[model samples]
Target: MKKVLLYLKSYWKFALLAALLMGVEVTMDLLQPKLMEKIIDIGIAGMNLDFVLKTCLLMIGITIIGLFGGVGCSIFSTIAAQNIGADLRNDLFAKIQSFSFKNLDELNTGNLITVLTNDINTIQRIIMMGLAMMVRSPLLVIGSFIMAIITIPKLSWIIVLITPIIVAVLLTVNKRVYPLFYKVQQKLDQINTVIQENLAGIRVVKAFVRSNHEKERFRQSNEDYMLANITANQTMAVVMPLMILILNLAIVAVVWFGGIEINQGNLQAGSVIAFINYLMRLLQSLTMLGMVLIDISRATVSANRVENILKIEPTIKADHKQDDTFEIKGQIIFEDVSFSYDEDGEPTLSNLNFTIEAGETVGILGETGSGKSTLIQLIPRLYDVSSGRILIDGRDITEISPKTLRKQIGLVLQEAILFSGTIKENIGFGTGQISDQEMVEAAQIAQAEEFISSFKDSYDSPLSQRGVNLSGGQKQRLSIARTLALKTPILIFDDSTSAVDTKTESLILEALQQKRKDTTNIIIAQRISSIIEADKILVLEDGQITAIGTHQELLTTSKIYQDIYNSQFAKEEKNYA
Candidate 1:
């Protein structure tokens, strides 16, 4: 609750104005019953028509004032709530962006999506309801109690006696419902996780003909979510009816006692009527207050979830002094580097020592799970080495800021991902501003220009989400083109050309050799042909570098490299035969 209140500090003025309006509205509401009492007792009782007419008009005017105040407060509260939600969401997104790869790995994409969208919405509603009702409901309850005492002192004991019971019941219900609401939210996150997985893997599910199995999984999650919500709401369902029952009983007691007083000529009819109105208003306010508590409980859980993410300190911090003024020479050296995904996990890479000189190309070959991808990931500090250091141009990678280090390297991953946008925008993603010639040249280098030109809109053609409209080879080519357009000094291609044909692959390699004279290239590939001409080749086996030398040197000296080469070329030799 305190954390949520702190978020509203930026909009204190709007909150204050809303409070003031609510106060005015409550004051006007309290005055209305009193004026009605005056019209009935002083004017009607004395048969004074002018006084009754005037009091009625005054009551109407006060009603209008109350209505205006109510609307004004609502508008202010809504605007304040929206602004707070927007600011909080923006801050959350920025914080997520700043987190290191390890941080993101700890938080799954689906859970983060839930926090950003659903949880934020819950907090917004709570803010709006809390601000709007916090002042008015309490004021109505307390004001009506005081007004009731003054109007009919004998009957005021009934309110004093019954109000405590009602409060106790509400508190009990809140205590039980609060934990259930938290559980409901957890179930909702699970449902979201299931939905997200299904959408992302829908093709795989269909390929395996497991749609029914997936549907059952989703149905189970949805059922759990429904059951949780139903349980929470069912518990809360006790509140309003019990409140109405207590209110009716209080009304019965008032009328029964007031009739006796009226027969004895001790209490007037107008005062009794006014007291009943005040009691009903008091009950209505109390109901709204109970509802507010329910919202606050749910919001409290949601705010805590959001705050947890916001409070996560990034593992990687940028150096304040590091700047991009110095140009990269594209030299990279890893000295006895070791790494693991987690503290408890076995090392993924061990004693990894290698060096690639400026303008040189190095090829990395390893079986799956041999840490080939993990090795390159360390170059940009995506995941820091658990031991040893990586250097670029004799400067430790850690000493350089991530922004500067990444700006010097262009990477193409095994899975080519594209956002929903035009081809031109996807190619020029983070370059700030790009010229048409540069975009075209990069596309041509990656052999993507031919297909791009075939499109009716050329570079302006809209891409579906994740470039779903493009073929696997086209997407891979575009991803390569996107990275190439950055023109960074260090290029890391992690099996990015696996989808391209042998002819196209040759063309891309030729282009890289011609255009990347000053760029250090790191190629991770399964095909020996992709790296046979490299300056150096390193063969990894079970997280250890078993062989490191030129392709011909390894082929002659290393049995593992020799076997891999023979196995691949043997197939080609048979095809020629």
Candidate 2:
């Protein structure tokens, strides 16, 4: 709540103006009934047509004023709500970007998506509704009560008695409904997760003919989401009818007692009529108050979720004290570094140490689950070292600003991800002002220029979402080209060429050698041919480096490397016959 309040503080001026306009609107509304009472009791009863005409015109003018005020309030509140929602979403996105990979591992992408879209929308609606109703409802309730007392003091007691009862009922409903709404939001996150997964992996689902299974899973999630929403709406549904019933009972009492007063000449017919109007207005405002409470409850829940994200301090923060610029020679050293996903789990890498000089190519080869990716990720500080230090040049990676450190390295993962954009845009993603010549050269180096040129639009051709229009090898080549376009000093290719044929792979390797002679490279691949020419190869087994040597040295010494080489390339070697 405090966090949300702080976020809203920036727009309080607009909120205040909206509140003031709503107050004026309610004041005009409350004044109308009083004027009607005046026309009826003092003008019509006294047979003064002039007084009635004058008062009716005054009422019309007040109504016009109220309408204008209402319109202004609506405009201001809508603007404020939209701005608040935008600011909140921007803050959430910034927070997500700042989080370390370890933090991201704990949050689902789908859940974050829901928070940025659905949850923020919910909170914005609540804020708009709150600003529109908060001041007006209370004014109507209290102003109507005061007018009633002035008109018929005896009848005002009914309002005093019934208002609290209505409030108590609303509070009770709110208490029960808030938790259900919170649960509903959680269930919504799950549904989003399932939908996102299915959309991303629809091809796999169809390939295995598991569409029915996926559908069933979606159905279960959808049903749970539906049930949660129904439960919350149903609980809130009770508040209105019960409020109406209580208001009706209060009306009956007012009429029953006022009739006696009229018979005894204690009250006029005009007062009775005006009192009933005020009673209805009061009841209507109380009902609006109930709705405001409902919105408030839901907003409270959403605000808490948003605040949870905002309050999470990123494990990775830029070192403000350190110089932003460093002469990076790309010398990477890991000194006795150890890491584990969880404290209770065995360490993925323990006491691992290695050093690579600038302008060197190092290959890491290992079976699945051997922490090959984790080992390379440390240099870029994707995940912090759990128990040791990683140095870039002579400076600890942690001591340097993350921006500076990452700007020095370019990474291409095994899974190539492309956003919906043109080929040129994807290649020049980070710094969007690359020259056409630079883009073409990078694509040529990745062996992607020929295919890109095959298209009629070439660089300007539109890419489908995630580059689904491109083949797997094309995507990998484009992803590599995108990395190369950055021209960073240290390049990390995590099985980047796995989808390309040997001929294309050889061309890319040749390009890398010819074009980036001074750059340091780290290659992680399953194919022995992929890393055969690396300056040095590190063999990993069970999260430990088993052999560190050239390929020929490993072939003579390491049985594991020999077997992998023999199985993958021995046939090709024989085919040379």
Candidate 3:
């Protein structure tokens, strides 16, 4: 909570101004009860019409001054709170962008979204409320209490007796509701997770006829979220009535005792009336403060959540001390590299020792879960090796800046992700600037230009979110085109062409060989034909390299490669027959 409050440092002036204005409003409010006492005891009792009228005018003028203070406070508080929210949100997003793949994996997308949007909004509102009421309530309470004591010191014991009970109630409610609000935020995360999953995979749900199942899943999550909210609100709702009951009882005690004092010679009617007014102001301010404290409790929970994100240092940070001015030649060496998603778990790629020379085309063949994707991911430093080192050129990859290193390597993940935009924008998403000729050339190389040109708008055609309007093959082609546009010295395709036809895949591979011959290429593919002509192929089984040779050499040298080639070849022959 304290860490998150630093966001207000830049806007503290506005917050302080708001608080000062609120104090003006509270001062006016406190003075009004005392003026009423003057009107009753001095002006009315003495039968002086001029004094009564003059005091009434003064009260009206004070009310007008207070109105300006209240309005100014609102404007400044909004400025302070809104700016703080925006700055905090922007910083949080920037921090998330700096996170490594492992960090992202550790933080759930749903939870991150909830914290960035809902939790931040909660803190923003509390800041606004606090800036206004935080000053007003305490000043009003203290001023009113002092005036009440000065008015009738004997009657002040009623307030002294009631204050402890209100404080006790407030403390109890605060303890009970903090955990509930925390649960509410967690439930909201679950709701968001369910919604995000359903939307992202809606096509799969429809294809599998699992819409009903998804609906049930969403229904259950929503209900849980709703129940959590209701439980928290119900706890707060109970506190409100209990507080009002205590307040009303205190007021009744004041009225009862004040009547007795008035009947005696100790208190006048005007004094009794003023004392009741002061008592109401003081107690009501305490109640309002109680409500603000409850809100502060919720905001504290949200602050901690936001603070947790801000406190996280990205697992991978670029070393600025290393000289990164040297040009990359695309020679990648993995020396005794090993990695695991979990520290205690088995290594996903154990003792990976390989060297791909500059401008060489290397194909990686592995069974499912052989860590093919993981291996490619390591090349881009998406996830660093748990043990050992990767060398680019001759320097350890850790010595190079990640941004500079990634710029020289073009990676196409197994899943092709496209943002909502025109085809041209999608192609230029990474490089930022591409001439029409360059864009067309990349699309052609990926075997995507033919289908793309068929559209009325061609490259200008708009794409739905994640390119849902395009086929799997088209999206994969676009993904390849996007990466190919970079024209990096090192290219990695992690099953990027699997969805395209064999002929299209062949064409793309031929294009890559012709156009990027001077660039190193690493391809991970399931099909033997896709990698048959490669200069070298790696056969992997259970995260270990079983074979490394040309296709014909592998057929004779490696049992795993032979088995894969024979099974695939036999299936093709049987289909043709």
Candidate with best lDDT: 1
Q: TM-score of the candidate numbered 3?
A: 0.97
Question: Which regions of candidate 2 fall more than 4 Å away from where they truly are?
Answer: 573-577
Count of residue pairs whose backbone atoms collide, per candidate: 0, 0, 0
1-577 per-residue lDDT for model 1 (tens digits): 5766687999999988888998889999999889988888899999999999999999999999999888989889998999999998999999999999999889987789999999999989888878889898999999999999999999889999988898898889988999999999999999899899899999899999999999999999999999999999999998888988998999899999999999999988899999999999998898889889889889989998998998999988787777556568899999999999998799999998888999899999989989899989999889999999998998988878888889889999889999999999999996977899999999999999999999999999999999999999999999999999999999999999999987899899999898877789999999999998999999999889999999889978999999999998999889779
Count clashing pairs, candidate 3. 0
TM-scores, in order shown?
0.98, 0.96, 0.97
Q: Model 3 residue 333 lDDT? A: 95
Evaluate model 2: give its TM-score.
0.96
Cα shift from native, residue 293, model 3 (Å): 1.4
Clashing pairs in 1: none
Worst 10 residues of 1 by lDDT: 319-328
Expressed as tens digits, the lDDT of each residue in 1-577 for candidate 2 is 6787676788989999999999889999988878888898899899999999999999999999999989999899988999999999999999998999889988888888888899899989988888999888988989998988888998778878887888788778888987898899899999999999999899999999999999999999999999999999999888778877887888788889999998999988788888988988988898788879878878887888899999898887886786579768888888999988777789998888888899999999999889988888888888888898998887888888888888879999879999899999999996678999999999999999999999999999999999999999999999999999989999999989989998899899889999999899999998888888998999988889989899999999999999988887878878776
Better model by lDDT: candidate 1 vs candidate 3: 1
Alpha-carbon runs more than 4 Å astray in model 1: 321-324
